[model samples]
Target: MKRRIAILGATGSVGRSTLDLVERSPARFEVVALTARGNVEGLADAAMRTGAKLAVIADEARYDELRDRLEGSGCRAAAGAEGLVEAASGDADWVMAAIVGCAGLVPTMAAIEAGKTVALANKEALVTAGALMMDAAARSGATLLPVDSEHNAIFQCLAGSRREDVSRLVLTASGGPFLGSSLEQMSEATPDQAVAHPRWSMGAKISVDSATLMNKGLELIEAHHLFALPSERIDVVVHPQSVVHSLVEFVDGSMLAQLGSADMRIPIAYTLAWPERMATPSQRLSLTEIGRLDFEAPDLERFPALRLAREALERGEGAAIVLNGANEIAVQAFLEGRIGFCDISRTVERALGEIDASRPRSVEEVVALDGETRDRTSALIAESRP
Candidate 1:
């Protein structure tokens, strides 16, 4: 039987890459639903292309437009948070929880409660509410698979190994567009330059995170949660080529690594076809042409985001939530030309300083904390500006 799949963020880059795999062999999969936050046109296009049965737009105002666009196409349309939750609860064998940021949490939890195998691309969900998500998965028997390249690589390497035999997880980084540049050079960096990642193509926010090494930082927190490893066991290595996704060091003095082209589809397909690998049309890695891979330690003095992320993960009083929430706000500010690239980490650090001592007990509390941090961080940026 063909697997029933619902893509939670069908209009973004990750969603598009997933669509490529599903579209290639429609006989192997069915797209039950597709959703976008506000990209009605893109959502409609994706729905029609996939012949999805349901489409939802998180922006309620765009519902009428989405509904009209999908008219005569045999796909139903919905709007708002309720719509998002309903779509997630619908009949689907698997849900690609690809909604970019913290906004993806509730619906992703809904998918988990619905007992769907969740392909998690939204790192914030785990970073902010990993314990909650893991608990939900354990309760509901939902399989939560990691879709981020680093986490996915670690997953592959540790497939049949005992947790005790595992030594550490080493995540590779592309080092972003400012790899060779000094901190002085980064202070005056522009958004376009930051988003121009050294290896992988990505959106402005994530690309900016790469520039500050904060993307790696966020991934570290995600790894800590997803792999059930502590902050000390997971490490980040700067690999500019982007060929080696991640490595798993064993207690026996050896390491296992997963290497491939920097294509999102590889990991997406890996998760989608878990336990049974599916062939992907991604560009094959050419080690001959891309001769050598270099490794180096991340510069903590230059990229304080990584250090801040470690501190947040350690503090645990909604610090990860604050770190992610603040970074999101600051990244948006920088992208809008409201702040400097360096100020992104500054904003996150300030939010980290103002954190509530109480840790969030539930996903609801996590969401609330994320919202509160975003609001606070936004104000902090504004106050610092003039």
Candidate 2:
């Protein structure tokens, strides 16, 4: 039977890549639904191509346009966050939780609650509510699959292995465009420079996160929850090659690594066909042609986001939520030329320091803390400006 898939954030980079795979072999999969925040044109186009049964626009203002576009196409159109959530969990065997940032959490939770296999591309869900999500998965019998390249790689390497035999999980980083730049060099960097990631193509926020090493930091926290590993057992290595997605060190003095060309489709396909493997339109790695790979320790003095992330993961008192919210705001400000690139980490640090450091008893508490931190971080940015 063909798998019925609902792709959230169908207009974004990861979403588009997934669509490419589905379109390549329509006989193997069916797109039950497609959703976008406000890009009705892209959403409608995707729905039409995939012959999706439903199209959703998270922005209510675009509902009419989306509806009109899909009117005679036999696809239904809906709007708002509730619509997005409904489309995510309605009539689908698998849900690609690709909606970027924290906005994706609720519907992603809904998908799990509805017992759909979730292909999680949104890192914030795990970073902010990994424990809750894991618990929900266990209770609801939902299969939570990793779609992020690093986490997916780690998952592949650790497949069929006993959890107790694992020693540590090492996530690889391309180190972004400012890999070897000094603190002075990064302090005056522009958003354009920061978003020019060295290896992978990603969105502005994630690209900026990569430059500050905060993406890796956030992934570290996500890894802690996803792999059930502690902060002490997880490590980040700056691998300029990015070919080695992630590694798992076994207690038996052996390290297992997953390597491939730097492409999101590979991991995306892996999740789409979990417990099985499928071919993707990704380039195969030519080890002889590449010739070499280099690894180095991240610099704490230059990229304090990594350290702050470690502290947040270790503390686990809504600290990760604060760090993520502050970083998102600061990155948006930096991208708009409102702040220097270096200020991103500084803003996150300040926001983390200002938060009450209270342990969240629920996901609602996490959102409350996230909102408070974002408000304060936005105010700080405004106050700092001339």
Candidate 3:
């Protein structure tokens, strides 16, 4: 039987790539539902291409437009965030949790609580409420599959191996566009320049995080939850080539790595076809043409986001949620030309200082802290600007 799938964030980068894979293998997977924030054109196109049974727009105001577009397409239309969450958890065997930012938490959690197998592309869900999400998964028996290339790579390398035999998991980074720039140079770097990632194409917010190495940091918190590993056991190395997605080291002094060309679909396909591998349309790696692969230690002094993220993961609970929330606001401010590039980390640090620290016992508590951090971060950005 074909797997029924619901893809949240159906118009975003990962979602588009996932649609490509599903379109290719129509017999193996059926697109039961698709959700997007406000990209009606993209949603309409995706629904038509995938023949989704239900299509949802997260913004209620766009309901009429989305419905009008999907009219007579035989796809049901719904509106608002609740609609997205309901569509996500409603009777689909697999849900692709690809919605970006903290906005994804609710829908992704809904799928988990419903005991649906979730292919998680949203790092914020794990970063913000790792304990809450993992506990929910444990209670509901949902299979949480990692869709990020790095985490997915680690998952593949750890196959058939006991968790106790693992020593450490090393996540590889492409180092972004400002890989070797000096602190002085980066402080004045423009958003356009920062978003020009060296190896992979991604959305603006994520690209900026990649430049600051904060994306790697957020991934660290995600890795901890996904693998049941501690922060101390996860490390990041800047590999500019992007050939090796990630590495897993065993207690026996052996390291295993998963290498692939830079493409989100490879991991997306892996997650979609879990416990089974399928051919993807991603580019294959060729060592002969690529020549040499380079690796370097991530400089914490220049990229303080990495240090802050590590500390957040160590602190647990409110820390990661706040860190992610603050980073989102700061990055937006920087992108809007309202703050300096380096000030993003400074704002996050300040927000961290101002927010009260506590162990978030529930998702509600985590969301509350996240909102608090973002508010404080926005105030910091405004005050820091001339």
TM-score of each: 0.98, 0.98, 0.98
* lDDT per residue as tens, model 2, 1-386: 99999999999999999999988878889999999998989999999988999999999998999999998999999999899889878999999999888889888999998999999999987888888899989999999999999999999999999999999999998888998888889988988899888899987778899999999999999899889999999999999999999999999989999999999999999988887888887999999999999999998888899999999999884888888889889999999999898899899998888877677778788788878888999999999899
C-alpha RMSD values across all candidates: 0.9, 0.9, 0.9
Q: In model 2, what lDDT does residue 44 have? A: 95
- 140-238: candidate 3 lDDT, tens digit per residue: 999999999999999999999999999999999888888889999999999999999888888788889999999999999999999999988999999
Looking at model 3, report the run of 10 residues with the lowest lDDT sum: 377-386
Instruction: Residues 178-243, candidate 1: write the lDDT tens digits.
Output: 889988899999998999987888766788899999999999999998888999999898898888
Compared with the true structure, model 3 gives a TM-score of 0.98
Candidate 3, residue 321: how far the Cα is off, in Å: 1.0
lDDT of each: 0.90, 0.91, 0.91
- Candidate 2: give the clashing pairs: none
Superposed model 1: Cα runs more than 4 Å off: none
After superposition, which runs of candidate 3 have C-alpha atoms over 4 Å from their true positions? none
